[model samples]
Target: MEQRLASPLLQISGLTRHFGGLPALDQVSFQVAEGRVTALIGPNGAGKTTLINCLSGVLEPDSGTIIFQDRDITGLSPHQVARLGIARTFQNLRIFPRMSVLDNVLCGLTVQAGGSLLEALLRTPGLRHRERRLKLTALEALDSFGLGDKAGWPAGALSYGDKKRVEMARAFVSQPVLILLDEPVAGLNPEETAQIAALIRQMRVYGKTMLLVEHDMDLVMGVSDHVVVLDGGCRIAQGPPDEIQVNPLVLEAYLGRMSATA
Candidate 1:
């Protein structure tokens, strides 16, 4: 009999992070397959954010290996990781408050821009061409998220949900291989949440892979291809949403907090 090989787009092993004497993440390990949505769920203080930070290069783990596209990117800087085609949205919106929405999205294209300040100042043909292309691509990204009309609006003036949508647009403009979303629907009303969920499904249709960290069970169950449950800085269970919904460990972790409310 032949053994099948795993084709994971992202893989982690022995991921651990400690703060002073407390462990925020402990021996965490998981694989995110290409072109599928993987949801990371856990209660407060379960290390979900810490794990994402490590993965996105916002925080370095005490020990671990992060392999993406078969490259060892562990300990890379955030910009270095972004250049490697990994983009992330924060739990709190990180948009430029005073910039126009279109300009905010244009920032994602900086890595692809031509030459340098001198070339741009001299109005070189190459720099001009790249700028034109970036603007067009930025418009298309905004259109996909239904924000084309708000291109000139100041990012600070947008509502919470629209700000989140803009952040998603900015992340997508870079054509990332994998996207990490942290509490994307947090503080949104049902209608806005549903809209964001729809946008996520649209990205899946485009074959975009994602790792989502969210507290909304309904959204997680509806969109996730695989669910990884965490508790006290450890992975308790991982499986399809259906299996995760009924897993004893998952149930126990959420029993008191979610069972009564969900």
Candidate 2:
């Protein structure tokens, strides 16, 4: 089924996380609208990745409630969250180094329903059919990211830029309703960053909801439909990209002073 862009699908309320007495996220709240690209932007230590970790179930929050599709999903395990149709890419690459790029992507399709272990051991008709379909889907996902030719190569042998794209393809293979992108464009050159930004925009055209945590201001402003700013573990501003660009508080927190770009 196709999702519409006119409604809110994820609501985060009073989300907070602490690490050894230091508050990484404090009372953070936001709504991710269906079918929109939402970027989470802030300074180096503003809790962006911590918030993402909480959302993707890599870390449990100290206090908060996460509502997705009208259900409270706070504190769910990573596997539980993935089964609920949320996919994520981490700040560090999570690829299987020795595996083929195609196989790395195919791993994401584990969510695709297959028969039980016993049935698979017997090569049941249903499981075979599902596995074949999943392979085709995984290949298509790699091709869409411009990495089809490298599908047979070792994932660890690729350049950093290509590795990032592979990670993205893996997350995208799950076909989730929401994608949590943690620093998708970090440490890339200008050309690489531009390519990724374009891919994100393409995903947006297809109505995939994205919550991206990126340090690249240009990419964030160019690809995001909405921007949320965090400072000292608190949400300081949020709105359309243009509005956030001019927000005084955002300028001060992100750049240490007011600037035209905020």
Q: Write the per-residue lDDT of candidate 2 for residues 131-191, one digit (tens) a residue.
A: 7878899899999999999999999999999999999998998799899999998988999
lDDT of the structure predicted as candidate 1: 0.87
Give per-residue CA lDDT, model 1, range 1-262, as digits (tens).
Answer: 1112279899988899998879999998888989999999987778999999999999999998999999999999887888788988999889888889997887776643423334533556765667788889999999999999999999999999999999999889888999999999999999999999999999999999999998888899999998888777888788889988888788888655565556
lDDT at 112 for candidate 2? 29
Q: Model 1 TM-score? A: 0.91
Clashing pairs in 2: none
**Prediction 2 global C-alpha lDDT:** 0.86
TM-scores of all models? Answer: 0.91, 0.90
lDDT of each: 0.87, 0.86
